[model samples]
Target: MAPYEVLYGRKCLTPLYWTELSEKQIHGVALVRETEEKVKVIRDCLKAASDRQKPYAYLKRKEIEFQIGAKVFLKVSPWKKILRFGRKGKLSPRFIGSYEVIERIGPVAYRLALPTELERIHDVCFMCRCCDDIVLIIHM
Candidate 1:
């Protein structure tokens, strides 16, 4: 069944195909009250569904926090047929630099001490673009 049919308790009808079938018709105050009741039922159902799914949506989410002066690697994505950080293709590095966090701009944003090569790009980046673990080798 369509979602509209289930929620509204009736199939949606186009104006061209619509016809009055019942001899008795609801009018005035009763019609208003009936419409309000249907709207209330739909709202209740929507709220219930949202509550049930909220937990599952947040199940894998972890709140990350970074401190000032901590080292973090910046994640970089290289586009196809384009050069990024003087490198391109499948063999290009996924992440670059263990840049130091100069300051925490907000809960999820931090200012990094980016190298001169990345001067054109913004120094501040979101927490999702950074990783605290020293996984990549620092070839200095």
Candidate 2:
């Protein structure tokens, strides 16, 4: 268990934790607090140090080289079913199909050409470079 002060300061929680807090009112507050405390500690340590040189490291945008006709599987996130009177709807499969890369918009983001069925549902979906899960960017 973390201290109360420490539990008062986090930016975000893990994806697994979202389910745990679905029914709770003040969900993730404790985790946020803990994150804040950790940040405070880091800040204090940095202030005490005379040398304030190197900046924080972050992921740099990598150059993506892919052809327009590259066939890539677009990952999708799970849909949460609403429970009404103890009845639930079936959840759709996470990744529906492999989409052809229509165009490269940005380093990480891309414009995909999906099937007609999926096309009727969504326009463009965002691809996760790290994970296999893809999210529906927008419905067209």
Question: What clash pairs does model 1 have?
Answer: none
Largest lDDT belongs to which candidate? 1
Q: Residues 65-128, candidate 1: write the lDDT tens digits.
A: 7788877777665561146645566767666678888998877788998878678667886434
- Badly placed stretches (over 4 Å) of model 1 are 1-57, 80-82, 85-90, 127-140
**Model 2 segments beyond 4 Å from truth?**
1-65, 80-93, 128-140
Question: lDDT of each prediction vs. the true structure?
Answer: 0.69, 0.54
* Deviation in Å, model 2, residue 73 alpha carbon: 0.7
lDDT string, candidate 2, 1-140, tens digits? 44653777654565444344544575367767766777788888988663553343234634555567665556554432122112244554344345677887766667788766465444455553322464433332
